[model samples]
Target chain A: MRKIIFLISLAVVSICSVTTLSAQGIQEKSLTLHHGSIKEIHSTLPTCITVANDGSDAIEIVFPANVEPYLEIEIDKRDDILSFDVIDESITHRELNAVLQKNPIRVRMSTAVLSDILNTSDMSITFEDGSVGEWFQVINTGTLFVNGEVLAAKKKIEYYNTGTFTSKIHSYNTTILCLTNTGFLYTNGYTTAKYVEQSSTGIENTDLKVACEKLSISTTGSGVIKYEGTVDDVEIVSTGRAKILTSKLN
Target chain B: MKRLLIFAVSLIVAIAECSAQQSIDELLNREIDSGTTVFKMAVKRDPETGEIIKRVKEFTTTGNKQLAKEFVEAFESERDNVDGWEENRNGGVVQITAVWVNPKRIYTITVAGSALSVFTQTIYREEDKKSK
Candidate 1:
């Protein structure tokens, strides 16, 4: 029988190469929600969770690109509002401990060991709403944005010194906005810059017009970012509110 | 060779008598302000008041009429602990401000065209405010 069709075609090519390597692996999903029970987990890559709560309460874990009907989670009992949807293999763990022996809340979902945004260089963005821009222009180097989104240029810097300027400095505790070398404004705490031509040989003019909500310019040189709201060219900028337009608002 | 030129003039008088008592918190040498242009200076201390709060100096001089006559001879050699002094001239630019009191100090000098710059700031006059 032609060797039984070559052993059933090598067992159907070994079960189609183990179902195509488990559908291109990297899918973790874990769950552990007690205290009223509302658990669910699902992943296809892009996870980083650690919700360890039991004592010393203080637990707030909401992830899924942070809500937007994208797996909505807003549970703060006793004000009476319960909305739920996380059914993926329908509740287990003894039916989530019989619904956490009548709602107590102890969630423990897994699958979030992520850390490979090209091995991270450092990124910190926080804009529950928006605001960042009084004056902005940071030519290049390990991006930094405050008052919410306006940064994304992970790596690709070149300017071996036509006059030095290197980047990889990120330290923000917050005091409003202030990022200079020639751009980024808004500061209502303590701002001081007195570099009257600090040893110039040329090209160090730091042009400024000022007014911002959340600005960060310099896509590549002669930066003159004027904004009223929205003008995509790159580097995170969205959800308006940026002043500083004495002129250039046509 | 005249005893090697008197042993190289006694090794330049023993390195100018070991730098004639250096210290202005040291570091200021191009043979001690020759043509000047020294930058990057420090001497800050105050890890919870260990004193010597500051002394951040920066220098630059391109002759500027000999560093404005050596900064008016370093503000007239700290004229009796200079309690206050100021000089400002427009047009060819020249600025000098001084304030010193024993260990506390602040001296600034600026001159244009041919450039000349200097700043020395240090404060922390304690020791029971020196009997005052």
Candidate 2:
């Protein structure tokens, strides 16, 4: 599993460069979804789906103080995703084929200590600005304009590094490993993260998935998101590195 | 000697961990330019000729269909729109003065000599449309 993930991560690192594209001259198509999150098969539907946190830089969801946020079950269809950077800006979104995008989501996990991140325990989210946080999964990657510079963070990043650079990082409170790519793998009272390969080929794949989950951020004070980047097929979360796999959801 | 070996190994792991960090630029990594919507115009077939024009003449329609209807007016309006509107925005309603069907392409398009093309996409409402 680890081997597969490493290869994928290496590949993702390369593709990450040209991820942003323009939505030029596209005929404006307005969509309306009844719910919050929408999930579908990509082959059947290739509709564009954007997200909005209403009008806030972050979407606020106050779950039970200790309750973790899971995959937003229902896929939402809306004419526009609310742009938070602006007071009242709207974004055009489309319905993504689940197969193409895989299942990217935003989950709320508990927070760990700085020691955990420094220790490289489980997953780690190291930001270019040196701000670190943790999560279980990323929903989408969005542009982060810090101090006036725009950066790209891939969406649905399960595991990755601070991208050859960083000053800030985010780590989660969970032990990091939940379900392995092959079967159920757990991290019991240890900082070390291991992979359980369902098949020999999945060694890297399993490890990468585990790391992604480890590095994922829990949008607690701020909502967690796995954003679709300017380019299709890639999602960004908080302007960070994201390594994804094509395995079916368990 | 053993402690020194452990320290060296630990240093390598730390260096490897640090190497993973990239100068991933998030700021200025925007999706669109100025969040501005762009508009373009083109000419279709000369209605009198009733002959189809080449693909380069106008923008292609997005959906799948074949043998669409031919028209002339769709072009004129778009030309005017391009000359007039300083800016176009998403969700903003712009008229497609000249819209002709590309029978061969099986789609609708903003003909040349027309204004900005306005797509007639549906909006999803929670309640029934009849109620609204």
Candidate 3:
């Protein structure tokens, strides 16, 4: 009797989910990119995530909002190729794959679920490519602190996105001869950008600047910051070679 | 002239040092210019010697089924010495290991929806041991 009751309940749940998915017309999508080369990653899923060449070998990707649980994620590898599939049997594979390749993976889940996915899911690696063969190492060069929260890279391009994002330089004796308008830097999220030196050695001669509303910096190394654009408020903590150009901070 | 010469030498040294420190397999994987980060590859390094033992690359498709299928086709084209492959339906993942005995190299590829990780390692061959 108990077994029969359990089976009936399972059937009812399955039927309800199928009916709900049909009503919403959720689709299945798969995305594939060569493992070695990834350049720019931008999404229009209302949740904007931008990433660049910061060396990270493994990163979790985000799908649209609350659809995390209902969705089935599959990673298929054969030969040397890898395929990422977001399965929603209700939708056609052809249509879903096309959309994912072109834009962000969006699902028509409830807004509440969207909030949960954004807040809980630690999906990362928005962009990747071979511009820097080992961007994972480059990105790990330092720990960026934005308003006391740690920040990870969102998008990496050969050129800086000058007007949109602010990039923090944590490299040793790195020189940006000049900053062009190719691509700028942005925080992991919209927050005050800062740097926390994680290396035992000090960082030196890092020429960096940004155009943002509020900027906070804290570093325990020998590094110099040059602001190339306007800013509203700035706070800095320095230890060894840490200095911000007072003349340019205004 | 002296300063220019010093700068040139320094640049060459720096480039050489960077190349020497990185594994050739990692360099090869890093050279590809595909625009997605879902796929990942790694190498197994010996603990005491710090030498690379093998290389493995793994990737997944999340919204482009055709591209994923095509990529698999392309990858299989270069299967020089695949020892074995297994497909699991539980999560629809695949694990393939290719071994080249002469070169003493091993490649293991694994793909799961949440993770796609591959690794490669070069092993000491029995032939080398027998010759010694």
Computed on C-alphas against the true complex, the DockQ of each candidate is 0.02, 0.01, 0.01
How would you encode candidate 3's per-residue C-alpha lDDT over B70-96 as one tens digit per residue? Answer: 434433543532444443435566565
Candidate 3 structure quality by residue, lDDT tens digits, A1-250: 5332111121222332321232235442222222322322222122223333444333233343334333343222222211233345665544553443433343211110000011111112222221222111222111111121222232221222212333342321111122222122232222223322212123333344443434444444444443444344344343334444434332
Model 3, residue A211: distance off in Å is 30
Off by over 4 Å in 1: A1-126, A129-146, A149-171, A174-250, B1-43, B49-52, B63-123, B126-132
Residue A111, candidate 3: C-alpha displacement in angstroms: 50
lDDT of 1 by residue, A64-109 (tens): 2211112223332322122223323454334433332332222232
**Regions of candidate 3 where Cα sits further than 4 Å from its true position:** A1-183, A186-250, B1-32, B39-50, B54-56, B78-80, B83-96, B105-132
Top DockQ prediction, candidate number = 1
DockQ-based CAPRI category assigned to the predicted complex of candidate 2: incorrect
* Per-residue lDDT of candidate 1, residues B4-108 (tens digit): 999999998666534332332233333122212334344444445444455455555464586466565656565544668788889988787776554567767
Winner on TM-score between 2 and 3 is: 3
lDDT of 2 by residue, A1-250 (tens): 5332111111222222222211433222121223232121111111122223232222221111111111112221232122111011232123222221222211211211111111111112222221122323321112111110111222111222221112122221233322211111211111122211111101111222222211222111111112111110111121112222222111
lDDT of each: 0.33, 0.22, 0.33
TM-score of chain B of each: 0.35, 0.19, 0.40
Each prediction's interface RMSD? 21.7, 13.3, 19.3
